[model samples]
Target: MAPTAKPLRLLAHDADDLAVLSAALQDAVAKIGDIRWDAQARTLTMACNRFRWEAAKGKSGERVRSALQFGDVAGVQARNLRRDAKGAVVELLSMGFEPAEEAPAGVVTLTFAGGGDMRVSVDCLDVALADVSEPWTTPRTPGHAD
Candidate 1:
């Protein structure tokens, strides 16, 4: 029998923590599964397939469905948030936090490869990553720019 993948849950507390989370999420490819915001809860959640990073010997490429949640969210501004984005492949390029003028929290931006961006204004940096499935291989070869 194949070994079952263990679910992962990661939290971010500050800018540094966010950076770590960002690194883990880098190069992740996914179709925007769900975009949800709760006014009362002050949270924004986006679900997607996150390329799994592993250190297992001989393992090449892998990916797993995952959800990323942002808490203390004051608001969410997104470009190209549509049904078409539901199944279209998107890659997370980078993530950054911009300090707010008055609010203790700041804006966290998630930029994708195809110009799709989601900015979350939060009371504080609160991010969570949870894996939803077992990883499967997607072989890749290293490339070098000349």
Candidate 2:
């Protein structure tokens, strides 16, 4: 019998923790419209269909709906991304944090496959990732040339 997997939930309070979240989110895809920022709440969130790299084994794979969120966001900026193209999809490559000279305050960059990026400037490192639904079968796993 195949091994069973459980729902994943993670909280990132610092750079080291964020690295784990980044790995879990690698190859995740999201629609432009699914990404949202609420200025009043100082939060940024994205609903993503994330490749289940952690649970994946052998030839078969799948993706799970997940929510990635950042709190205490001071501002958000995008580069090489078209917010107007709501239907467009972006594949997440990786994520990293650049510390601000002021200490806990810093920028969290979400790098996409097609040279697109979204930077969230935050008051501190505060992020969460959680699988929101059951995984669905995927015939092909994501591949990279490198």
Candidate 3:
């Protein structure tokens, strides 16, 4: 039998960590599974299929349920956030956070390749990513420069 992928749980406490997490989540496909924000809890949770790097198989198909908790969240905004987005296979292109000038809170923006984006306005950066399903082999292989 093929080796099973170990369950992954990652925490992002700062900008650098968030960058790493963003890179890991690049090309991840999401379709509005459990994407929501809790005003009282000050947290934003999203469940999606996150592609992960495998030593033996390169990028593998892995499902991940991830969450970002901003202790001092002020508000949230999104563009093209829809249940019908399921048909388009939104691919995460990049992620970034911008510090606020007037308030303590900042904004974390997740940009998708197909022109959709989700922005999280928060006081601080706190995020986590975890694998929620068994990984399966994919046909995509990593390209070599040389």
Candidate 4:
């Protein structure tokens, strides 16, 4: 008999942005689920509470597992960025984010599953975004979360 397989959990910032995760990434995900984006409001809504992982040993050898959030939606900087599917560098706004000059192109929204539990650390948690390419073949880790 074939082994049980998982479903894909596809996520993206927008239509032009690349999709994170490989075919394996997709296969590992149970499902892509739903995604909602509000470019004007700069808000995103996603259903990502369904993904789960098997219990594993922690540093202390104790069983540990987290019901991590696995999805998000974000907006593209309409001013500095040009909507192109070719995967080129564009200007990402850094005004509301930080003192940086601008964000690279081909990035808008980012979804991360590697970092620890999502916490509000103005210095750490906020600076964990990345520049995503079309189909998300590559991820340029951004300095922070705007």
Candidate 5:
């Protein structure tokens, strides 16, 4: 059964704000084909099925379709990814930022499981995450070993 909840809409304009968004996006899974980097548009966007940590009440949980986007992206670099394999799926673990030499400009790193990660150089911190569809129940809530 669907919970009585509103879809999440968020924006990250600073590191603190991004930390909140990063937490919300933790454990989101997506296909490589759903990730896009538009050089001309200076944006990086990804469509993900995000585990709804906010809505996770006890063991009951859900996954919702979400769109994560970054603006003013100067460039992007990836590691440990099979870019050639469009069907490859990735689970996002966390997102962090390192400030550049200039103020407001920084590199945002998206770390995935198994050491795969993407580093995005940005003109400034500009990001948005929004849930686009109704959530469906998941079989289990995510767990991590200490």
Candidate 6:
């Protein structure tokens, strides 16, 4: 049988607020990083500052947009946000995942958000949120071990 993998547990904390995570907030704070995966829990984990962002009203009044910026005024609009009024729609755009816009709820979600986009790992040691297919391989004989 294949070895069973354990789930990843992370922590997301806003240095500024240290409370709730809102799009209005994430857009304001600059740095973001957290531990992603570990055979066991980590000690002295390393994190990097993430892109600084700013939020502005989008084309639609209900929707808010975020842009990634550095140093000077931010110019790149990254993602769009609004409440989930209709059925769920998850989209992959340039900045990050869209529609799943609401900051992860609960301490667990906060931790998971710290993990960032599961599609691409923020850190090398991070594990996938889903099953990763093993790379294709050709059968080998035990003799090949030599």
Global lDDT of each candidate = 0.75, 0.94, 0.68, 0.24, 0.94, 0.22
> Could you arrange the candidates by lDDT from highest to lowest?
2, 5, 1, 3, 4, 6
| Candidate 6 TM-score to native | 0.18
| RMSD for each of the candidates | 3.2, 1.8, 3.9, 15.2, 1.3, 20.8
- Give a tens-digit lDDT track for model 1, residues 29-110: 6666576788898888877766656523353656677888898888888786554556676778778988788656899998
Error of 1 at 129 (Å): 1.0
- RMSD of candidate 5 to the true fold? 1.3
Clashing pairs in 6: 10-111, 32-50
Error of 4 at 80 (Å): 25
* Off by more than 4 A, model 3: 1-4, 54-72, 83-88, 102-104, 141-146
TM-score of each: 0.79, 0.96, 0.76, 0.23, 0.96, 0.18
Give the higher-lDDT candidate: 4 or 6: 4
lDDT of 1: 0.75
Model 3 scores a TM of 0.76
Off by over 4 Å in 2: 1-3
Candidate 4: segments with Cα more than 4 A from true spot:
1-33, 54-146
Encode model 2's per-residue lDDT on 1-146: one tens digit a residue: 13486878999999999999999999999999999999999999999999999778777898999999999999999999999999999999999999999989999999999899999999999999998998988987888987
Give the Å shift of residue 19 in candidate 2.
Answer: 0.3
Superior by lDDT: candidate 1 or candidate 3: 1
